[model samples]
Target: MHLTLALASAALIATINANPSYYVKPIEDENDYARVLELSLLFYEAQRSGKLPQNNRIPWRGDSALDDRGLNGEDLSGGYYDAGDFVKFGFTMASATTLLAWGAISWPEAYIAAGQLDELRKAIKWATDYFIKCHVSEYVFYGQVGEFFLDHTFWGRPEELNTTRPAYKIDPEHPGSDLAGETAAALAATSIVFRNHDPEYSDKCLKHAKELYKFANRYRGLYNEAIPGAALYYESTDYGDELAWAALWLFKATNNTMYFEEAEHHYQHFHLKERPNEFFYNKKVAGVQMLLAQITGQLEYQKAARAFCDFSVRQQKRTPKGLLYIDKFGTLCHAANVAFVCLQAADSHGIGDPQEYRQFAEQQIHYMLGGSGRSYVIGWGRNPPKQPHHVASSCPDRPAPCGWSELDKNAPNPQILYGALVSGPDEADKFHDRREDYVYTEVTVEYNGGFTSALAGLLQLRVKSIT
Candidate 1:
């Protein structure tokens, strides 16, 4: 650690140790959740893969992804970019947007209390609108916006990058069930968010969701096969889990028995009864089980949910401080995702005793919020991430030179991403807040969704306590 950052960390640690909640208070936690929603939208604004909308509030970014894939003269514009890169991976965007909408649906009160309900709605609508655009036909969905080789070469704002951003899609013969199913899930979930607010829009979302689900079912293949270029990035080995996930959400949104039957069939066919241990975007079994438990109140679903939670907790690897470190690359992401599931299960009424699971969730979440001796959220709590591995954040305010040398310096990010959660510590609970180390300091919408969802659940618990 550099001497300056090291001293700053030491001072921040002393302050936090003196007061356990100094860096993690209820009011501040609510503020953090709201800020996360804001920053998630800002990340989208900074990396929008198409023409800038007139209503864009994020001033630092503008239209950039023009010449996006001359494939069939399709308009492949207006989706959130993937990570720090300008590519718009529809699969990942759909999944992240679905989870973000899930946070809104499950905890509307938290968003309202935090004064972020409108922003959350806007973010969900932005991604879902892009999904609508991606679905040009009944059986076709464009899956990607930029070529990896071309986009990876540039490390500047999305608006500044100008290159061949190829668009990829899947058709009836060339199937992409996983991507399509996840998009369907995102639309279905967002439909619920707007059902009361905008009935016409809700119907539009559900209509597209149903069509996408049909496409996913009619052509049962992974997306990478159709778009081979995506193999290196958003590849999927199986599509059954996504199918089941979409079906369940569709059933929930429309309250249709046929959708429920389809979900049940897919659930049984995929044997989700045996939940997977990982909590990343690729795997949906654990989250599906939690949702199923809540919807059906079935003992089997509850059993699976508990089994999955227990399996995650029992992983042999852990930081000496017991942070449930899953992998070095996305340590906090995995833990935060698991924490969300745990808290979701704990909130489900008539389920098994949720106290234990709640406690487990709290421990993992607290670790991310400075319980591990430093905070991982950018511009929050104590000793937060000063240097995030984000291109826009690395560059000076705008119209300034942003080079590799700028990222190498031991300085705070140029932008104050209040609620952006950085990739966290290693298995030993050690973290380096450096911009060059993307693994440790990178911020992504998906990562923020996971942590923000968990924090929303936590704040929901606090509201329950006070009332």
Candidate 2:
């Protein structure tokens, strides 16, 4: 038995080393640079042809479908339709900024995607302006700065809109009384952009960034004097998954040991408790943990990252028809979180059994593109053949199931999209057999961004290694 086990381990290592799919390249290098340039031309052409507009307001009408699969098949008629509000806070717009930032760092080729340096500058300006519009001066503040409202607590309160009155009073019990996470996310985005393009905005961005850090520290830290033992209430605590992302970005931009120390401190205090099994559902938290682990190279962080990848692999749902479903806790398999975790594992740890993670990612893409086609809206929902509960509202009557589709319709499906590299068994069956029906569904654009950004970061590292 020992001999057989040793042989199996050797075979697994060989497989991992032999397969490049087990390790995905980050979009940061020369190859990605060329791709970004090509994409930029396409974007420019789309703009000239009235497909994409000059402003950040997404051109949703007249071939405005961003999903290529949907557009190609002419199935882009149904699903949600609105002006490209990609500039709004607490939405995929905020996350896209992080993607752009990662692209700027790792895939500098993305800078050329604007077709020229001047165009690139315009793109940055547009993104920054949009971010600025999303800021809230105080809780319940009202303004038409962006497509989405900036008032109300993260938990869904205020119950009123368009009024100038403070929607919800600031209180310790309700640290999320305003867009705390979104605020932090905005600051991070603004900081990154300023760091690269506009030096003039650096001081302002830093000030806001520090304010965000201070807020998170004040209410979310375990040893915090202002709010002792308050870290347990993640729901209302000022810090959560998004704050962690902000910390990493801040550290990267500022290179401040304090920010790194603070980020590490939070990861140790708040995230490590759940440990390996923690990532089964919360992709945002999982993504944040992965980034922290990678940047710090802490053993505990690595262990957590491995645990998350393992849990994700184990949780894949296998359909009776022999299809593998890489969905999260609730919805039809989405690619964002799954892709991010798998890619990170493959890139960081080499995913010993390369085929397992690779095949799973591939199967998820197939199901998403083939089964759902362009209608592959990822959020939180149960596997097919299971009833989906109403978990959309903040105060839902009952808890919702785990999964990306059920979380928030507006956010990007990070469970599948970001770090996608298909390879593994068609495991769509396991989702149907799960006995636990109650699931908590909370999906925010902030978390989705962190998840994808972390995956991008991992890919960058892997690509650097291979090159």
Candidate 3:
């Protein structure tokens, strides 16, 4: 058995060495966490919707998607665009905001150390403000701003797109529990971030959050069926997990027993199991379990969280290069999200194996930072991607015509998308740097949020070790 194990290990090493990549050195950078955190803010700046302010960090981008007014004349103006497209998906936007806000709540010092707390705060406010606007009435909530087909037709700057973008909403008749729940979670989490800094705003946020949660619970139905437009994208399958996720955040923010009871009910209703290998916009089981374990110090929650992490580390399929594999398309995202869970578990006060979980999380993050022999982040390590599938970044500065030729072949992106993390390498750990390959080279706001959370956790662990 020992000899067989040795042979297998040697073969894996040989396979990893055979893979071709530009990065050929061990990862060693004390400033990586700071660098990534800075870049994440830049990504948010690029994805800004509505009137681009004068103080915007991304100079190349101007006012964009300003024409997005809701069907009921509600102002659906501000929020980050979803993925590489100029669309505002409320579910995804809320999920991203919740994760980003959680990172801020978990490790404010990391942002302070990196000198980006103000930027992070502004970014969080941008989304929460949009959420507040979207929740127009007791039941009515705007969930989407632009049509996928119409939005996908244009490939240039979001500011230049002058099409008639339609808006969609959810209410009692058109229920969207998942969307409402997630929006509540985002708002609840945001309230915590502003609890001390801005008491009035925090109370307002929490007030809206509670109302939205009530709406979600009262009208329990999927958004896709009611709205139909969400079917193509941002479609929600189950609303149970989202209910629990929102409830948990509300409980965290307010310490309300009612919210805790709701959270516990939904968590058990779903019969939380070992986390699946993939973490996507629609899935929140693993995240809920992990948070529950950390916050409540429950034995069941800890056991499930451990089982999920163990599945990711030991049972999940992996690339020869050591990345936990789910799909070749955005493989790094799954790893990044799970890395965050591991990192948080590592610091679970005393519920988890801090050393072991930290090691696992670090390995996954190192792979993203070039331990896989190439950097997946657009502007970080040696020979990072120069042609991410981003419309604004791919266009030349000011004068040149931004067309298919430029996107397909003419030149590398005229602007360096500083900290944008690309989708990443294939299942075999092979990468192609080009604009057309959206799966391997696209950047998203939420994607950056995941990386930011993971990096902040890493920085926190490092600081804890020294202190």
Candidate 4:
């Protein structure tokens, strides 16, 4: 690390570590969560894939993928790179946005207090604007840009990328209910965030959201079925959750009776009332029920949310360090996603046991923030993950040729990817901070989505909410 940055970070981290709540029961520590929230938004800026904005904060990132276009010459640029790699997978990107928007809506006061409200909204609009371009028509939407296999084969700065990145889309004959529905949810939920800030943009988001939801409902099929290339990487397990999930968001955004009824219909048809084992891009049943519990105060939905959160608290598998070990890949991501959902349940009115759920959520988030021996989030806490399996951050500054050779460097990433939460430790709390160990060290937008949101929710608990 640079001498100046190291000295600065040391003092800042000390304040966080000094908080008594770091070791004992949860206490109001708004500073730490607020700092993490600020850093989280910066991580999204580093993941941008299109033309560079003048106010771009990531100095290493530049205008790339400007030539990205669909088969019909539809512009397909400006969304976030799906992960450490440069591919832009719409399904997961939209899913991340939905979670981020949900957090912004739920904890506006926290964001405002952190002085990150504007940046957070900008982070969201970056994806929403890209979605507008990708939604070329009522039935057609670009689900992915750049093939996974081809993109993964190269390793260097995205600005210097020279690989062929063909855009993939789904239309009437090739339906992708999961992708369409998730995108619809992202737009609808984001519409709520932008309603007062920019009414015109909010209206545009709702228009596209309604159209995409209609397309998803009319032509139902898995996104991976439409685009086989995406199947290899981000395959959809089922579209039912997304269908119901989008309906719920649309209902929340528009307050339309039809959307609420459709959400209920999809919930029953898809059998989404049962507690989900995990929550992420592919599965959202737990979130669906939790939102229903909050919105309708229905007994069935509340019971389901309570059951799911209770399992996460008492029954879910955990690492020696207390991190929820959901899956081997992206362990921290899954844990944070669950943490965010449980936080939603905690914040929901009259959902008894808010203390247990919020405390559980705090422990999980703290584990990522170095409550354990090591920090899973890059550029935060002592001995944070350095050699994250990422391309751009791994590369040196411009005028330097970065290639596969750079991947073998036995040092920290040249550029610090601040606030990036890496796919974390194993069941025994074993984590190897090696770039080639992509299973554990790779960072992604989806990884930060819920982790960042959970930070915001936790921040609210530490500070006063807006009156």
Candidate 5:
């Protein structure tokens, strides 16, 4: 078994190096984490929607989804595709933005050292700019723009999309507290990210954040109900977590006591102290606890953070190779999410034996890089995924025009989806690079959010001072 694994690893490494289109050399050290951080930024660029700027790094991706607009023809043409599919889900997109912004704010040195600080800001700006458009009115916010059933039927490049994409929104009557709250968090967090570089933009983000937070608290309901189609994919379970999460971010951005008090109120009223199993686009109890610990230095929040990380490191089920196996789908995404949350917990307080948590994070991240004997990230490391279930990258470049035939083809994707993290292995850590097998091959914005955040955290630890 060892011999076979060795041979397979060799073959995968050869394939990766031979593919120049996908190759992105490391800065100075060949430590895979630094490259991982760089490629994760590429993934976000790959997922970009709307106008492709002159500085666009993705050659295959052009200006697509230009006509995406709000109900009143309000331009909402920026942001990103939610996942492998071509839908712009506000809830997931906002959650991803918040995670990315949090990482940038937490570890600016990591990005600067990696020379990804500029790219990172551009990534967050794309989403926030679109969000600024989505907030067409004080009360109303466009939640989604594409229909899933219709979207799933057509499998081609987003640039060639030829169908009606009716927009949906949430107003006073159809209030989506979860959606509003999460967006508020995203904007508030981004406000901090841009505070030094562009104070005006920062102020704008904070204004929207404060208004959205007010909207969320004033009228409460599940976001899926406001936009019924969202129930098919991203049906929110509870708004309590987002309410608290948004308040916490606002407090961090503004250092205002009212927001902190609101954060505490939401924390207790929503019972957010209960340690959550995972920290993805949906659940955020673990993140809340960690952030609370950082902001307040209260033993209560610190203890909760420690409990969550301790459970993850000691009690969580793992594959034979020590990869935390939380769920069947996006297994690595889940593990990375926990790793990032735990890293935050360890960083914020003297909780849970910081060294142990750090080691655990490194182990989990390494498993994603190559410890599993195969890289789960597209276009990097040994035998990385060559055929991720993403439409844009799956499509052949330029005038070739992709369709259902592209989906049916038995070959690696024509274009390399650099840095995109795909749907990971099953229970036993088994993964295949097949475009049709979305369960094991799909990529998403949320998948990269936590993974990249963890990478930045690890990079910060290793390369403390960048010359």
Candidate 6:
């Protein structure tokens, strides 16, 4: 039976090779540019309508936005409270990158998308101004800088003395304390956005991006120390998951030999001795590995990507009531991660044997929508189950008792229901199901408008590539 299954898998893979959409290519043409732009637009529209949740907010115990616990202050909570805000920034960069590439290949489409040149000029100006204002020091921390303490106490409030004091002290070096891989990714995405549309902002974007790249490079050697190898940290001071996303984006934008080389090194080292089944516990990292593989086009990377996807598919949860449930792992999900993987695969290998992937993505979409396009809040896990944690618990020689566990058995399922879908057409076709899965009472608004503006250029590039 195992041999037969292996043979069947081989045949399915062969079918993928037969399809044209499966092979991955750099965004070198109009069609590719269009696809990315379309996806970006869909994501943006979703955010505008509040179809995606913005659970990254701190709720006040009373009616006032401010509370005694630093939770009311801006700096107390980290910056991760707004899902829409993060997506806006991320998609903006993505769109801009696509447009820039499109312009290089098809100037006419790029020109038209630039709104006959003059409007494009205004857009560029606005983007430059926006980015300038958005620049918060040299780094972005996880929570609000100088806002509130973890327990919701004001930075300087003295509970015993009943006196108002300085909330907290900022680290000059780590001013924006939560400087992490995701923040770097946001910066990199924005840099590409500016570089494509607003030449004026390009220098600023590049400067910050290079700094982030350098920061990441400083820890390249430590990647192997973590599971899935080369995962980026949530901050410079700590490691979380093996996140290679920033590296992938950096390589895509710069095509710099060093970035690509580092990316390759990290990729190989992470997957060299890893098995397909080992990834079941951490699909987000696994999904990222698939994306890098598709982006780079190494056969080994492709194998790892395929194996991880297969593993994820096998591990998907099916509710007794007939609904499919994707296990949530710390603000993560099966739909978003799986869709990302499938899209990358389809873009890399074409569309062969993609039915499973497509079906799974669609199912996830349906689960999110609660049976229709009606919006609903989805919780972390309805049927919460204990799963392995992906974060490392200790070092190789001296393992820390309270450090990140290799597989966190007690970690909250990171299921994020809002603005998580990063790719695909923006249609309700069977995928949009509006059901009450979870609820988040508070919401926050954070915009990466500069990046979104940059995406206009990418759309133009997509049109040019196809024509």
Candidates in descending lDDT order: 4, 5, 3, 1, 2, 6
Estimate, for each residue in 1-467, the C-alpha lDDT of model 4 and write its tens digit.
Answer: 12332344345445433541221112234237876777788789889989988977677788989989989898887999988889999998999999999999999877876777888899999999999999998899998999887886899889888889998899999999999999999999999999999999999999999999999999999999889988777779899999999999999999998999999999999999887889998898888988889999988888898999999889999887788888998899999999899899887876658889989889998888778866777776667898999999889877988999888998888887878999988899999999989988988899999998999898888665433
User: RMSD to native for every prediction?
Assistant: 7.0, 15.1, 8.7, 5.5, 5.5, 17.0
**What TM-score would you give candidate 1 relative to the actual structure?**
0.89
RMSD in Å for candidate 4, one decimal? 5.5
Q: Summing lDDT over every window of 10 consecutive residues in candidate 6, give the lowest-scoring window.
A: 56-65
Q: At residue 35, what lDDT does model 5 achieve?
A: 61
Writing each residue's lDDT as its tens digit, candidate 3 over 119-200 gives: 7889999999898988899888998888888877777777788667898899898899999999899999999999998999
lDDT at position 331, candidate 3 = 78
TM-score of each: 0.89, 0.50, 0.91, 0.93, 0.93, 0.46
Residue 288: error of model 2 in Å?
A: 2.5
Candidate number that wins on lDDT, 2 or 4: 4
Model 2 spans > 4 angstroms off? 1-174, 177-179, 201-203, 219-240, 271-283, 318-334, 349-362, 371-467
Shift of residue 271 alpha carbon in model 1, Å: 1.8
For model 2, give the RMSD to the true fold: 15.1
| Tens digits of lDDT, candidate 6, 308-402 | 65655666454432233343211223233344445345445733356676555444434432332222222111221112111111112222232
Rank order by TM-score, top first? 5, 4, 3, 1, 2, 6
- Residue 300 in candidate 4 has what lDDT? 81
Total clashing pairs for each candidate: 0, 58, 0, 0, 0, 69
Model 3 alpha-carbon drift over 4 Å, by segment: 1-31
Local distance difference test scores for all models: 0.76, 0.38, 0.79, 0.87, 0.85, 0.33
Q: For residues 260-310, write the lDDT of model 5, one tens digit per residue.
A: 999899999999999777888779889898999888788998899888999
Stretches of model 1 off by over 4 angstroms after superposition: 1-47, 51-57, 66-70, 314-316
Q: What lDDT is reached at residue 267 by model 5?
A: 92
lDDT of 2 by residue, 66-123 (tens): 3211111321111111111211122233344454444445433323322233343444
Give the Å shift of residue 11 in candidate 3. Answer: 46
* Model 5 clash tally, residue pairs: 0
